[model samples]
Target: MLSEESSTSKENIGLTSSETSTKPRSNLMASVELTGFADNGAGTISATLGNKANKDIAKTVITQERTTDGVWTCKIDGSQAAKYKEKFNPTGCVKK
Candidate 1:
């Protein structure tokens, strides 16, 4: 039973007595990185994928499209090709 005092509690703010039928629940933060982002999905999906790529990637030719999802491609510099011939990915790997 919800007493008048309990009904107005800050925790239940913006909720109504009818809404009280369903108790409130907590949510955990979700994150993802790279193609190998957890192979298994979460029970409660709450991922925050950044829509913008805040990167300054430039080379012989820089091609990008909004429709392209998760796939980031970059042209290899002609001069640097030899140094990155056996690199990991097509864009060449840079260890920080």
Candidate 2:
């Protein structure tokens, strides 16, 4: 199991410049391969508790795949992806 709240560093994707600690953290659930991603497999999930004030939690089923050229791609919720595409870059995520 992964920690919901792990020590973060500046290199971490969501961390800001003020942060300086360093440690590799798993952003996605376990992958079938060494790449830390899964395309269409069972037992893959990621949960996030957003914000400090409100207890808003989101449990997402991670879906990842590699292109023919070997580039990593993923899928988020279709509607959310459409709205947040510019910022979130939900590439290769198609409506299901």
Q: How accurate is candidate 1 locally (lDDT)?
A: 0.25
Each prediction's RMSD over C-alphas, in Å, is 17.8, 10.2
Regions of model 2 farther than 4 Å from truth: 1-57, 77-92
Best by lDDT: 2
Look at candidate 1 and tell me the lDDT of residue 37. 21
Per-candidate clashes, comma-separated: 0, 0
Candidate 2: deviation at residue 29, Å? 6.5
TM-score of candidate 1 relative to the true fold: 0.15
**Model 2 pairs whose backbones collide:** none
